[model samples]
Target chain A: MTEKDLIDACKRKNRQAQRLLYDRFSPVMMGVCRRYIKDPMEAEDVLVEGFFKVLTKIGMYNGDGSFEGWIRRIIINEALMHLRKNNQFKYAEEINPNLDYTEEPTVLDEIAAEEILNLLDEMPPGYRAVFNLYVVEGYKHREIADELGISINTSKSQLILAKQRMEELVKKRLGRHEI
Target chain B: MKTEKNISTLFQKGAERISVQPSGQAWQRLESRLEKEERRGRVVVMRWVASAAAMLVLVAAIWLWSASMQQHNFAILDAAPPQNLEDLENVDGCEPYCLVLKARAELPAYYANPVEKRN
Candidate 1:
């Protein structure tokens, strides 16, 4: 069935249609959730909640944008809410201005998705959240500030700190020849 | 050393390409929650319908009662009193005979017979 047809059936609360939609989108959405949530189980929880919302609130989709993009936004918001509930954004105001940028430039292309996620896991929650919001999610510093309840400068600092920490992680990984 | 932007871009691209299937039981968990939510939604709708039905019943009952009361009042007004009773209503300190006359004027003849105590 076409996406429109599937969406229509799901809106009608058709179980078959709901299953089809979940089967189609859950993997990618789980990946999206995982970027923000370190725990696989928590990421799965967010994914499930996100899909539930996507199905239940499908009527609000006005066809103004890509359906996948709409789903992505919902998943991202769910992940953010999970983070907020866990107080991951609490330290967003602790700005460290003296971030080190001296690490030798490692080839980013050489790292796998798992390694990137591992690097993210090593960073503080606030730094990781800011980095994901600003970089992966493409939110501007102002938007990130609004989302994390921090100032724009804090968002910027957090992103810088996240990157510095990622570089250190990558350098250590390179030393171990894991890449 | 890779610049922050490069790393960010790399991470974004890599994350986009990666895919991991959910655990086998994940779908079951989600389906169960959806069913629970659906049940809750149905309960809300049922409650609303029941409330509306009760309100409609109350309004109908009130309407029927008021209509019956109006019909009874109209029947009383339509019943013509004896012509002399209009004048009797103005009588002051109604004497027993006047009261008997007023009863005779307001009630039908068959009912009024009991009011006549004087010869």
Candidate 2:
């Protein structure tokens, strides 16, 4: 069936259509959830919750843009809400302006995706969130600040600190691998 | 600096390929929540309908009661004695004395037919 047909059936509250929608979008939406939430179980919870929201609010979709984009926005917002509920932004702090990493930077292609997630796991919750929002989600500092309820300066600082910490983790991993 | 951009690229690329399958129980939980919300919404609609029905009944009862009260008032008016005694002034063979006796109720039995005395 066409996506429009599936969406219409969903609006009519058909269970089969709902299941089809979930099966179609859950994988990509799950990946989106995992980028923000750390625990697999919690990430799954977020994914389910996010998908539930998408189904419930499907009537609001007016074909203004891609359906996937609309669903992605809902899932990302749900992840951010989960983080906010956990007080992740309370620990966000301003980075020192003079801080600099002059050492030879590690190349990212050398690290596997699993290694990247493991490195991300070692960082603080606030820094990780800011990094995910700024770098991965492409949110401006103002938007990040508004979403996380932090100052623009704090958002900038969190990104800097997150990147610096990731670089440190990457260097250590590279050293151990070399040894 | 180049590494910073590359780090972003690495995550973006990984995000594109990473897909962890959710547990089986996830759909069950979501379905249960959706059902609960649907039931709640139905309950709210039912409550509103019931309230409106009750209000309509109350208004109808009040209207019926007021209409019956007005009908009762009309019945009382229909049964009441006439207020205008001047209407009896034009009666045949009823003199001023007869009218006075009838009005006072003090006339003797022999004078009960005042019109006969006038004859």
The top-ranked prediction according to TM-score is 1
**Number of the top lDDT candidate:** 1
Over the stretch A1-179, how does candidate 2's per-residue lDDT look in tens digits? 99999999999999899999999889878877877788989889888889889999999998899999899889988989998888776654566745774534445445565666677777777888888877777889999989888778777777877787877776777553321
Task: List runs of model 1 lying over 4 Å from the truth.
Answer: A90-104, A175-179, B1-5, B78-119
Best candidate (score: DockQ): 1
Estimated TM-score per prediction? 0.78, 0.75
Q: In model 2, what lDDT does residue B44 have?
A: 100
Worst 10 residues of 2 chain B by lDDT: B1-10
Task: Write down the lDDT that model 1 would get.
Answer: 0.79
**Which tens-of-lDDT digit does each residue in A1-179 have in candidate 1?**
99999989988989999999999988888888877888999999999889989988998987888999999989988998899998777664556555554444555445677777777778877778887877777899899888777788787777887777777777787553423
* Chain A vs native chain A, TM-score per candidate: 0.87, 0.86
The positional error of residue A41 in candidate 2, measured at the CA in angstroms, is 1.4
Calculate DockQ per candidate and list them.
Answer: 0.25, 0.24
lDDT of 2 by residue, B26-86 (tens): 8899899889989999999999999999999999999999999999989966875433456
Which 10 residues in a row give candidate 1 chain B its minimum summed lDDT? B1-10
